[model samples]
Target: MKKSMTMMLLLLVAMFCNAQMQDPVKFTAQLKTGNTAEGEIVFSGKIQKGWHVYSTNLGSDGPIEASFHVDKKDGVELVGKLTPRGKEISEMDPMFGMKLRYFEHSVQFVQKVKFTKPTYSIKCYLEFGACNEEMCMPPTQVELNKQGKSPAVDGEAAKEEEAKEEAVAITDTAAVAVTDSAAAAAPAALDTAEVKKLWTPVIDELNDYDQPVSNSLFYIFLAGIVGGLVALFTPCVWPIIPMTVSFFLKRNKSRKKAIREAIIYGVSIVVIYVALGLVVSMLFGASALNALSTNAVFNIAFCLMLVVFAASFFGAFEITLPSSWSNKMDQKSEETSGLLSIFLMAFTLSLVSFSCTGPIIGFLLVAVASEGSIVAPTIGMLGFAIALAVPFALFAMFPTLLKSAPKSGGWMNVLKVTLGFVELAFALKFLSVADLAYGWHILDRETFLALWIALFTLLGLYLLGLFNFPHDDEGRRTNVPQFFLALASLAFAFYMIPGLWGAPLKAVSAFAPPMNTQDFNLYKNEVHPRFTDYEAGMAAARLEGKPVMVDFTGFGCVNCRKMEAAVWTDAKVADLLNQKYVLISLFVDDKTPLPEQIEVTDTDGSKRTLRTVGDKWSYLQRYKFGSNTQPMYILIDNEGKPLTGSRSYDEDISEYMDFLNAGLDAYANR
Candidate 1:
């Protein structure tokens, strides 16, 4: 229950953080004119601190430059390019491989125009990209309007008219304050009910919300096929293949009729399993199942359930549905006539095999449900049913094939035992999730790795016939498959031993807890780049006469870890980063709170408070570079000018080397 509450709290915190990181720039525009037909128009931008707006004349290689357009009027003529009037920061952007100009804090742009008529009105708009230190938003446009009249001819009156014009311009600009008015009218307080609604984190199904349903279905279907194949080797379902096919042959003497009935039986199995999937989907909606995936209570329950299943496979106890259900179906199979009887017989097989297939099916369902797809369960069941039914149908069609099949015996139990070990190992992953979310520190990286190593080692010994379980035969010789599996298991167990000392085991990195969770480490003394504060890194780069490599990373970023393990570990890339550049890794997902909270009005005029270190870095990314994606690598010179094109999550070492060398060359030449 405590873990469950922790999970809910974590999700709510994530949602709140996401909401606060939105719309980093605000804009307002006005027409500045004196008592003349000619006047200048100014566009003012009030950007969030740490965020930046691109200059109108930024190069094509960088982000989209800020630009403006004035609607053509009968007498109004636009005279010069929009000129930025503020502190324009110039830097060579590594992401774009060119120099770019941008503004932080606030900026105003002026455009001179002439009106032929005494009175004129003009409509205009400006387009610009707003970025912070971490990420970039898409370019957006803000519209503006100006209405004016010619000044009086008298000198004193003209001066008064100019004053009036200035006052009217200020009022007109204030009228166009799109952000301020909406912010003012917004509810000052949110009700508890409304807060509850906001607390629900909106999971984007898979990683991409735009992913097609068919793609998800296809992947789950493949998973089902793999599961069915594993289930086929288990003791419960394998032995029945011959017995069921013989019954079909005995009932129908005619070959053609027997084949047709066998196909019907296979189709029946498919329908039954698919129907079961449909029933599950109907009982708990997809959204609920998706939520269950991250629910701490559900994960704990699932972990316990898997433990029970692993014990069952290890011959501790059997998990079975009520005998009445299978008995009723068996009676119907015997009483019903022809096609209906065959279908009932298939249903009976499913029920009788439930003890073994049930665990596998249940495990599969739990895995698929987490994907948040409506049809994934059905598709998965369809695939599993198809794989299970194929052998039964084929053997019935050709009884000769049954004789060629290996006899089911002690080897089947070995397969079960191996799977039992696997299940026990995977159960730890769920526990680790709860541990990480709650900061319980119960199952740290070394402890989890130790448990897995022990489990696989025991499994390998059992496979080699060194130990006997209740179900294992006393004097059976190890078969070829068994020998190889045992060897593989032992090898895998040995491979994980190094991970205890902080080796980034790339293969199992996804399953293991993060490296930082480890209490002890031997690999910490390597000559890696320093991941210090951003300002300090820039200062170091300037003092040392070297470039700076800014790594926009996240603690929770899987790809970032992968890149560190794979590409950055390469000798050349590592050398360049450690020796030639001052590196600073800014973690966008860091949850550490700031010393004091700072509130800023967002681009939409909505208020956002930066209370955490991550929030600050996220704002920095969006404010400076206009990008939010992680594993973003940028190289800059002492003057804070970018040295080369930026790199993202590519694992190709050659490409990374090139990126590093290009930056080094650019810095040297500069």
Candidate 2:
């Protein structure tokens, strides 16, 4: 109970820190009118003290480099790249693991655009990355869209209306521009201070309410501990514990020396694992981990690796190092003395247990590598090693405890087989990632669920002795623990049955394919994205006098699917989205080809071809909204004014209801 409370306290602290989160850098865009047909979009970024923005020319393998994109349209042409108009420092960035240029305090970037037509519209957006001592913010977008219109076509009518407006302006006597009777109701005008605040972008206000990214290190450490605990019960590690404990008791002259040496042995284990983590970090680093995890080729490779490990667990093969390595370590331990000997003994144990512990270590490292921080891998290793060493420490303090320990038996094989099934389940996650990345329809939501249902059901049957694997003892009777585990497996399979026809199944949403992937969805309260085009959705909302809700999502977004399964399924959220607002979903990862190839000036001014519908919508998202992260949500009125703040991947039901309700109130008040 005390441990549980400590865990809860840590969680609450994390939540509170997230609630008070603030960005260290802020950027705004303004259209400076230089001439009738051309103007420069000036992007000014105010970076807080100690925070810096990367320069515009870092290579692809480095941190996010600032750049601009001028979307291709008729009658508009980009003059040049986004030229930096501020002082820059050329130095090394630790997070980037390379030498590069960056700007501190503040910077200004400008892009020149020309309009051929007298009256025309054009869209442009800029992208950049920022970091401080601790954390690096995700790549952010800033939209700098501007347009021009021809002067009044009828001079007489314009003059008459202008004269009448001037008469009303005299009567009002206030400095505020009064065009109608509505302004006459107010007696006072805004002061200079208030006027300065009026031009702040609505997108910034929306972004101020974005959900915090919860990539907590504590949570990753907890995952490592859980993996280590599972490894403790495996055949190789469990049987060895008794012998290890007896050796320590018999070897030392006193209990104090024995305890000290055991402690050193445990430290050796932690050092070894942490060294491995450091090696991994040095090889690829945290900056590359995110891309490696999301890349389709990488996912395919990881999936195949897991499958091979699972095959070994199922007794198809044995994965082990040469016997000579362990024998050499044992021989060294006998020849050496003191701490070095004990360390060598621990090393021998690791080599001997490779067949069982290797897969767990691989999974743990893979899981932490995607967390986007250099320290994460080391922290994960520390947690796993500590958990693995706790039993060794306890045996030194109480040497006789191993006499009551469970002996190695077929039960350990049961644990091994259970882990094999789990590995198979996780392999699907990698496959799902690959499929979504490449737009393959083979692993749709229903199909993924069907496969899982069959797999888990077979596991349950095997646990109940209905079947046997290659190394299973013939006709062994099921024990109480095995029976309960089988029951759980079968129950989980039953739970997934409803997911075939579109039940949310929030439990498995993180692993299953998205609901949109399913061809049929009969969930009664489902809220659909009726408009895929942004302009059409806003136009419809204007006609109906309802506010617009735009869902910025991606085909590969796991959190988006989780939100649909968990939060959107709630009755209040569904009702608000379905009845009160026009819903538009913009998928940034859509793969359908566009009508023609268009040249793109990337963030670094490198030219690339934008040839897909996904590219078009992704360009629009950054060009108009100034955000690339998903699932991003924003509410706007018919006149294209923001109704409320933006939201991200958070699953708090009450908070979401308040978000929707606030938009409704703001729209009505507007």
Candidate 3:
């Protein structure tokens, strides 16, 4: 018993020693009120130990983040900015390599506060977590009221006190606790305060970011299969199946010879597609890949192109070049060396089916390019081309299978129309990105849902043979392929309907607006309750002395989607979001207008009213950051100071957490 007691005491002492082992960090924050009745807050964090803090480059799902809010009034605007002083550390995780910001000895995070009224004192809370090289502690929120005793001596001191209070209010226990029995019964609520206090600084550190790549690879592979299936229905590829089989049979005179030629043909197709991907990668380099994925201009262009492609698919007009171009290629193809003939044949088919294949190709390119890497687009295109080319190769291996393939007829046209609807539906996504970048309120959450509903409803009707365009046959029963795809489409449409009334479509959570933006939602509880509107968010920030994270994201932004699907799902990332940050999703494509009286001039000297949510956010993004990309996250200190060029998130969630933790650390010490 004596020995056991000695060991226990030693362990407790060691733990306490570890907790107190951290080097003292210095933090300073200031608050100021302006003529316009707004608030500005600033914070600077200084660390004595070699340990460094991260910048305000918070990810969707990451650690405890730095934030500020004003608890004194309503409609008081607060913005924030973080300046990081440190060296960058590069680390590789399973997903990607990323650079983290840290300091060895000392650094500072500054916060500025502003208000319409010249208030000199603020009562707020400061929340933070501490860690050494080996161990970490839970987060803690310090409730303190800061006031300069001699406001008349140094005006700056008064301002500084106010700012400190505003910064501290970020983690203030001022919120009225929900009294519902459900809140008490819920598992997450049991340790809410303790979790919030302990997790704040270490929020970014406690994450299971070690998911294997096999799942990601599998998802891509599955997408490839889906693309292949979609391609098989196109008129250009569908007719060729029968034609190739008959040609092989006639030329070979024997099954063996026919199979050999078919095999060669398939090999040529794969080579051609892969080469195309490589060539594109080589041409664009890394910068192009980055832009392809997130460039606002590119997204808008792609969106418009899809509209045109969809129109063609709907038989409004054929997007075809002169037949002479194909004839010339054919002649040249025949003259080329032996294997090149197969490539030429593949090229010929692509040209003949340009109208049918163009939209799919464009969609694939857009999806890949949004991953913000040079190799992403190339790999995506390779996947798509390979999927498309496989059928040709497979048919060559078993010409008999071609006999059972669906014949071309009215169903083909119906398929084209169906694809058109899909193309049109996806087009809005690009537009949404551009809208958000430019603040064009052309499509909000409600508007987007409404459009999707109409598009899918039409698709269901077309599938059931109740609706027909001039290009579609008026008489035809839905075939097996049509039946299945139509059913899937119909089911998807029905699924989205509930989302309009506030359903958490977790399966496609990555594809929709955040649950916060929905006016009506069913599954939301107190922990992650639905945000009523932008006004409510703004009002809360004014009242609580908390700064907001204006997330410039879009429904169709592929990178935005990828980040949601891949990065935010990490448990660490989710925890931070639920506890640390006040998330404000501003869809750039929302088509609502500010009052005409509220029209304002932008940095580019353009005058316009806030006609759309996208327009306002887009203008702010461009003028403020010179960037027009989806998944653009901006962290402002309570006084609206933009923390530009901080440590940001990419594919790696740890790095993202590093940014969040660093920002919070800076705020805590301040």
Taking all chains together, each candidate's TM-score versus the true structure is: 0.58, 0.61, 0.51
| RMSD each, Å | 17.2, 13.8, 19.2
Q: Local distance difference test, per candidate?
A: 0.67, 0.68, 0.51
Worst 10 residues of 2 by lDDT: 166-175
Model 2 stretches astray by more than 4 angstroms: 1-215, 528-631, 634-646, 650-670
Residue pairs in collision within model 2: 67-603
Please state the error at residue 621 of candidate 1 in Å. Answer: 5.0
Error of 3 at 93 (Å): 30
- Ranking of candidates on lDDT, top first: 2, 1, 3
Best by TM-score: 2
Q: Provide the clash count, candidate 2.
A: 1
Query: What is the overall TM-score of model 2 with all chains considered together?
Result: 0.61
Using TM-score as the measure, name the better of candidate 2 and candidate 3.
2
Instruction: Give per-residue CA lDDT, model 2, range 1-670, as digits (tens).
Output: 0001011112211211121133567777765543245556678888877567878877765666788876645556678778887989885432233567889899988887665654556666667766553334444556544444411233343334334431100010001121122212222343333222321235455556655444457766786676677778888788887788778878988889888888888888888878877888788876676545666787787778778878888889988999999999999999999889999999998899889889878777766655556776777777778888888878878877877777888877777787788777767777877887667677888999998899889889988988887878877778998999899899999999999998877556546776777788888887789898665676577678899988877654445665776679867789899999999897765556665655544444444344455555555444345555556777888765677667666555556788899989998898
Model 1 residue 106 distance off true place after TM-score fit, in angstroms:
32
Q: Candidate 1 overall Cα lDDT vs. reference?
A: 0.67
Model 3 misplaced stretches (Cα beyond 4 Å): 1-210, 248-258, 479-487, 519-524, 528-670
